[model samples]
Target chain A: MPRWEPDAVGRLQAAAIDLFAEQGFERTTVAEIAERAGLTKRTFFNHFADKREALFGPVSERQRELVVAEIAACAGSVSPVDAVLRGLQAAADVMFEERRAAVARRREIIDANPELREREWGKRAALADAIVEALRARGVDSGTALLAAGVGVLVQQMAMRTWAEAADGRPLREHLSDALLSLHAVIGQRSV
Target chain B: MPRWEPDAVGRLQAAAIDLFAEQGFERTTVAEIAERAGLTKRTFFNHFADKREALFGPVSERQRELVVAEIAACAGSVSPVDAVLRGLQAAADVMFEERRAAVARRREIIDANPELREREWGKRAALADAIVEALRARGVDSGTALLAAGVGVLVQQMAMRTWAEAADGRPLREHLSDALLSLHAVIGQRSV
Candidate 1:
């Protein structure tokens, strides 16, 4: 066995989701989640700031960092939308490609609790801001950058919903690109 | 003085904002706001459920109902984007056209507090869901309806920020229409 498990944080998140669903998010305790995961409370704290953080903390931060970095690194030939798509594709590969079951369960937990849902909104808003900043750095104006980033995040929202519910095990990037196409179709032929 | 005040709710909102800005939301009490408004606690409770409710209670609910009803009323004779814009224009006419300064202050208070910010987001999310339902009722598919609603809400968000900060004192309806136009320009065009 490896000296350190590759997915300690993932295990903690899984355990937390199981506990939250079996009971309610409000009633489930961190101690119970730790016990279920066969990890010490110290280990849990090392991985997540608190019980709520287990569901939202690391994944959001890592995704933000990855997307912003990827956008910053895109070649000059790419359009802003394509750059955002590229960034989202990179983050999706690391955070979501093989984690469908866990992602679905986590979504259920968030949907069931108003607080969690609000936090999820906050996370997405923060990510949108990060993407906008990256675009601005790449010389996009404030207005266009804001709109493109908002559209990209909206596509992310749609793609994630489809990914969690779709029967076909298609990659999230496919849905994301499809959503961008749909956005194009809807916005149809207006001059920017 | 009129027997029935025209702006009892306005007075209450102002008092609540002052108290919250001065003492913070959690520390401020409903009774204090009522007293500051020269009304009894019963009057405050009659207008709102609690202290926090004073800031968000009526405007949010009224906006949602107005937009959804407007969309339903425009069920025919327009595309989905046009329908959503019509709904948003109706809301701007009712909720925000004359309340620019008051709206700015309310936004500031919410910005100062995490709880208020979350509730504001919750209200925005609720409004988006209501729009989606209205679109679906008009025979739009669930996916397109959701995207239309999301884009409409995004337009609302952008228009609101601009209106709140715009010194030109232009009408919110104009900004909203302008935003809808810009959204059409951005998403309507397919570069590929």
Candidate 2:
């Protein structure tokens, strides 16, 4: 049995990110992260399965839930792609708009490591799959659902990137709208 | 130094895919794959770095080169997304169209493994990066280039999936065109 620790996950995540950014992710250890967080290795194990999972934390899962819930709330009359965009925009508002600096740091750390990069790709794919399921629940065909999910993923990616990197103070939802318009223009400019 | 073997890469890939599909990818070994190809482990190393790489083989790199070459040859007058579609269509003709069965087998083997799916995502991203570079060289703005590349990747993914699964004898390029049109319609249906 383990004793309770207040805000242990938050402390551990902050400590882990700082250490990973300071000494590089490969060289950092779970023990070091636990020490920095003023917690025990057992507590670390309680929250995350490993060092890699620590890097990602739980925010992604929360965001996925928010997006799926938003999609489910969309009325059947809403277009499939529109529903996905609405879900992304809603999640961005709740999860990402306030975490600009932290999100940027996480992106940098993941970008620097190939294995982390792959894991990030897997996470994005999982989110897309969740979106697809939500869209299918609204009676959209499989093909349209898939393409809409694809576009939604692209919008999230583009919006998150710009929201994190750009010095401008635009909110993430605005970036989502911008990316959707940009994608619309790109697809509409088709040659074939 | 290794002796020259006729179509060594082809034989190794076919053998590896068959064994992986027959006896699961993790259960299969490089030695088993090499034996199935009637080649030594040394020959396998000379061709691919590992069992996973053997699964992907050299076809992806060849396709990338063909796509970049096609993009470079496109006149500046062509629109950015159009140029990307043309490049993808050109590569499909030379690399994928006639090898539908082979491509389907490879996709199945990759899809069965989570790690391989991440790698497949990475490969698609790499192709998108190559497209971005090609478009940048043509003086397209970076944002537009990235979005165009993103759309191109989506088009490739959808086309490859349908071409592999659909029993109808439509060519890969036709699927590419169809996917592009579908994407256009999806994006054009945006609510926001």
Candidate 3:
């Protein structure tokens, strides 16, 4: 057997993204990803369940866990929207701050494929549900929890888009903060 | 020749929803739905592209058109989020006011199946996109348009849940207005 690699998952993901971008997601095979990563197919299987999972798997679970935990840890004095924003910010600081290029590439791959876009939507819905559950645990009303969770997910989406398109290299957390502020501004603006 | 039915699409949808809810979506066949509706398979095909579309077809397109048209007709001085709300309200008044039971059943059917849930999410995303495009046509900036559209969708979701769960027979538009107020209250609530 070959020596163990510490970053097998990261390597496989990088290789998969590169392959999916260069060719197409449908055209790229798992074996090619493993080969490009200088790893065996068995190792790839050990890391990811399938080719699609290689693009989005454990990372989403980890992000969800981080966000939920952050929400749980937030002070009760914080407002519902602020609590959700804090949770999202905490997750973004760790998971997405340094992965701008990878995230952009992943977005492109998902945008190009309807199947991947469907899965992406599922993942997003799951994340929002998790946030809702967390908010409920904090004794928030179900209606408020759902709305705040939806807002959190929407803010994250807007922040991701702005961050991806930004020419300046700002951190994801900053984009998130800006997006939250923008949401406030948009919602607060009324016809005189 | 058989006599023509005025509500072929409605009959097919009702038949499909009943069959799907009873026997599960995968096990139910198009022919069974058509037979149950007292219509031929060709009639079902004329009404819907596939078994899945039977549950959600032209109604979604009509909802989109109503919303877009309402937004387009709103005065230029209207705020983006309010414009979206007005559009949603107009569509809800016409398309959803008397269809609470059917809407609830549809929600249950979609909730039970992951595949249907995915399609529902796609339809929702499409509606949001249409709203964004309408707002842009009115000269709203992309970011503001996106934010308003997201807020509008979020409010609609909250209103639907409330309207569905209410024991007292309240109109959907009232639930929508209440949801809008709740959103404002949630967002306005700040930590001192």
Measured by DockQ, the strongest candidate is 2
Error of 1 at B172 (Å): 1.2
lDDT of 1 by residue, A50-81 (tens): 77888997889999999999999998767777
lDDT of 3 by residue, A58-163 (tens): 8889989999999999998888888888899999999998888889989899889877776777777889989999999999988889988888889999999999
The most accurate candidate by TM-score is 2
Over 4 Å off, model 1: A1-8, A40-50, A189-192, B1-9, B20-32, B39-52, B188-192
- Assess candidate 1 and give its TM-score to the true structure: 0.86
Q: Rank the candidates by DockQ, best first.
A: 2, 3, 1
Stronger candidate by TM-score (1 vs 3): 3
Task: Give the Å shift of residue B139 in candidate 3.
Answer: 0.7
Restricting to chain A, the TM-score for each candidate equals 0.88, 0.95, 0.92
The CA lDDT at B155 in model 3 is 88
Docking quality (DockQ) of candidate 3: 0.56
Per-residue error for A50 in candidate 1, Å, reads: 4.9
Q: Is candidate 2 or candidate 3 better by DockQ?
A: 2
List runs of model 3 lying over 4 Å from the truth.
A1-6, A29-31, A38-51, B1-6, B40-50
- Candidate 1 docking classification: acceptable
Q: Score the docking of each candidate (DockQ).
A: 0.28, 0.61, 0.56
For candidate 3, the docking band is medium
Task: Report the C-alpha lDDT of model 1 over B57-123, residue by residue, as the tens digit.
Answer: 8888898899889889973767777788888889899888988988888778887887776676677
Residue B168 displacement in candidate 1 (angstroms):
3.2
Docking class of 2: medium
Write one digit per residue (lDDT tens) for candidate 2, span A1-192: 556788999999999999999999999999999999999998999899889888776877887899899999988778888888889989888877898999999889988987787777777877888988988888888888889998998888888888898998999998998899988887777543
